[model samples]
Target chain A: MSAAPPSPAPRAAVDGETSRRRGLGWLLLVPGMLWLAVFFLFPTIQLFFTSLYDPSGSYEQGYTMTWHVMNYVDAVTDTWNLFVRSFAYAGIATVVCLALSYPLAYAIAFKAGRWKNFLLVLVIAPFFTSFLLRTLAWRTILSDQGPVTSFLQTIAVLPDDGRLLATPVAVIAGLVYNFMPFMTLPLYASLDKVDHRLIEAAGDLYSSPIAGFRRVTFPLSLPGVVSGTLLTFIPACGDYINAELLGTPKQYMVGNRIQSAFLTEHNYPLAASLSLILMAVVVVMVVLYIRRAGTEDLV
Target chain B: MTGSLASRERATAAVPPPPARRPAGRWLADHLVLLLGILVLVYMFVPIGYIFALSFNQPSGRGATAEFESFTWSNWGSVCEPEGLCESLKLSFAVSLTATVLATLLGTLMAFALVRHSFRGRSASNLLIFLPMATPEVVMGSSLLAMFVSLGFDGVLGFVTIVIAHVMFCLSFVVVTVKARLVGMDARLEQAAMDLYANEWQTFRLVTLPLAMPGIVAAALLSFTLSFDDFIVTNFTAGQSVTFPLYVYGAKLKDFPPQLFVVGSAMFLVSFAVVIAAELWRRRRSTWSR
Candidate 1:
């Protein structure tokens, strides 16, 4: 894995039968791509159609496709704050995840030497334990009488009445923690691809460590940065678990609203509309961000 | 510490080019980033520690599970004492295993096609693979549920629905992971095998499959992990069945059980041990191959 073959070798020989091989290639793609088309692409299209269902329709009577564009209008008008809040929280959490993951990924890529694989294992080890269990554990640690909250109170970083649980800070903290690996792994992948000699050359030219990183290492790792931020932000925006467990209703993001609107309330139209809105905003942001970052290989 | 130190020394010795003697400041900078990195990794493990510790905590009553009431061996001793706890665990394993198999097989095929073949609609297929991953879980879940509802499959939502949903989401990740591995591979190995008069099938079976095995294994592990830990998609589709995550979510509504933490800790221990053993085996195998 450390070999880092700089130039990518060409893929398997084309076998010299373009037409037949084309059919063969399509055969291989049929199973998985068809699955995605049916389950993913179609469902999304189905969801768009569902979003146009009459607002009064419920799951019981089945929805009528009245093209009630008002569903989207109502969804935005009603939950604009939740949309704003979700993006805000996810943005903050993504930035925090980037800040924390960059050094760790940098170390693993360039500095860990023989310990890289072991340390990488440690990074992923926590996933074996369920995320819900870990998030619940955070609830205990941030509880009013828990050590973290108590320590904060004692230090006066928090007011006497203030606590970590049921606060936006706790919710964001959970987001940062849970989605951190998403940021780190991509950063490490891109960083590991970087040529160390480039940085060494920069140093040979008497560039300082920070300047070398800024000029050489950081620029090379931009692909990872773009993907990491996207990975963190997308999930953080959609995640209801952290907010539901670590926060109060006041701290609830659009995710919490979507969950209740769909599952609890059984309001399919509203849920579909909310989901569309979220997906649209995310797709737009991601397109612009990817355009700026210039990495079509992210997928 | 000594093992790591000795290994580091051996690692440097094995390489032909000795690293130049760095100034004190450079050495400090190098070690400082590594130290900072290790510290962050350790900090991430705090919750796992808390889970293991809390598993020993037999919360005295329904309201006390959030705090450590007292330490006792009872929770571990009777990990399955809570009703439906073992049942949910079994269901989760069954669901995740089936999903992992389906996702890995399909994804490996897609990855091979994407990386090794120039076919029509390939870029479109790549976009298809990317779409599910880019979409939020909530969006995917809601959309899937909408599709099911429209098809009148909502009433039959159970084990099968959960498996389908898991495979759908896990497929994208598996494709990407396997594709990365395939793209990085040395294709000359396959060409050499072919040049040696190995048939296409023989070369693929002997060379390509073994090379792709690591990525497939990783993708399978990832799919299983994602399926097991999944809440949103499963919740949307799992109508009557209770996977472990569903069980955990349900526990919060009523009497939160201390046994949940015990089960969680046991899972951590078992999985961590397996991972460490695999790493050791991989190291030994790599060294032997070298």
Candidate 2:
């Protein structure tokens, strides 16, 4: 293979070659970009408009574009508690995920030795099963007859005859369990890329282990933190399956409401408005989050 | 996607294990992270273990998933006992297969373009690719449904819409994963091929494509898994269609059948096997390349 060399191409030839490939590049891009334009960009614009439709319209009669901006207001006021609960639960789940994953990701990155791949696979293995099934597994685990409940009861953690299912605690547990992998993988990616010598260098400078981590390793891994949090927080914030399967109505998040509005009540305006509001809030939160994390390319 | 892990694993695998005997305090300190890791892994795996166990459970009582009455091999053998379960699985497979192919093709091409060519709207195009991933599943679902309804396609919302939605979401991830691999690629190899008088297409077919194959395969795997496991967007866009997640969710509203656990365990086992196979294959290929 090494014996087949002809002559080295000149610089002008390389430039010409690059220019020649430019048209083909966009040719390659158009199909995917067009798909996004149709499926992503257009739908977002469509959702924004649908959010402004008249709330009084129905499917049989066909909805009119009344530009009802109050749909957003009504959506907010009607489901304010759901919104708060959703963010609060997702926020807590994100924090818990970060905590649980940090040590595990750190171990995988710096300590697992030959078992790194095996351990990392464990992070995403649960997700290979049905998301609903895993959440339902929580339902069983937290049920009154389950071992967790019995143990908690015996230890005086839960009251006698008191249950865990249909509670906010169960719902939050599901969120944390389901999304923790999303947090762990990204954190592992960033942590794995960190130069091991940097930590040793910090130790040579007389900084303690905790101080070295805080002053060096942690800062470099903020990209993972930002990305991991965003990935976990976004879907966790929008998730209704955990809340629906493990939670009663009292524990329902905005996702439950939005879902019901679309599926059961057939209130397109309300659902669209709710969806738009969720998107807007998530985008704003992500932008501010990335800004604070100071890693613009977290994706 | 596995690129980050692949490079690090070999580097860390050579480190020698700690000595067997040590003081209690020192041992605890040295293995603290390891214990924490094992605990975290257990937390992640306990549910899967329960599901696998329940796959063989004989449901003598209601709330089948809630209690394990007796062990039976019937459920795994006859997973189709529950109505609509197999049908939903078929639909999910169809959607996932179609979406994965389209997504991998489009995303791989887009990745090559984004990495190799600087265009007028490349930055904006990158943002557009990132938008689908940044948006929550529920929002993405509802927005797509809203667009479908507005465009008078609500009556037709089923498999086609599900495929579209799946591809749309999966495409961005495919682009990013492949683009990362492409960006990390050394262009000198391709230039060396060119210097050896190989033409552009020949170079791509023989050298460039092989280099990008791992990333492409990873993206395709990711797309299929995402599409198959998807619930939120699939729920919104699938009017009369029921994918696997939807089927599982629907079962919860019913008798909460035991057969579903079989399905869950099967999914985990199959995907884990595929992952292991792919990893092994990649290792052999890498060795051959070196």
TM-scores, all models, native as reference:
0.93, 0.92
Cα lDDT tens digits, model 2, B29-63, are 44897789889988888899889988989988676
lDDT (0-100) at residue A19 of candidate 1? 61
How close to the true structure is residue A287 of candidate 1, measured as C-alpha lDDT? 79
| Residue-wise C-alpha lDDT for candidate 1, range A1-299, written one tens digit per residue | 01111223334455666666667778998998888888889999988988898878776877787999999989999999999999999999999899999999999999888888888888888767888999999998899989988898999999998888999999999999999889999999999999989999766655556657887899999989988998899999999999999999999999899899988898988988999999989988987888777777674
Q: List the residue pairs that clash in candidate 1.
A: none
Q: Against the true structure, candidate 1 has what lDDT?
A: 0.86
What DockQ results do all the predictions give, each relative to the true complex? 0.39, 0.41
Native A-B contact fraction in model 2: 0.72
Q: How high is the TM-score of chain A in model 1? A: 0.94
Task: Give per-residue lDDT, candidate 2, residue B182.
Answer: 82
Q: Whose TM-score is greatest here?
A: 1
Candidate 1 lDDT tens digits, B1-290? 44653564466456533235345567888889988898899879999989988888877677466777787988888878889999999999999999999999999998887777676666677778877877999999988887887788967999998999999999989988888888878888998998999998999999999999999998999898899999999989898999999999999888888889888888888888888899999999999999
- CAPRI grade of model 2: acceptable
**Where in model 2 is the C-alpha error above 4 Å?**
A1-19, B1-27, B285-290
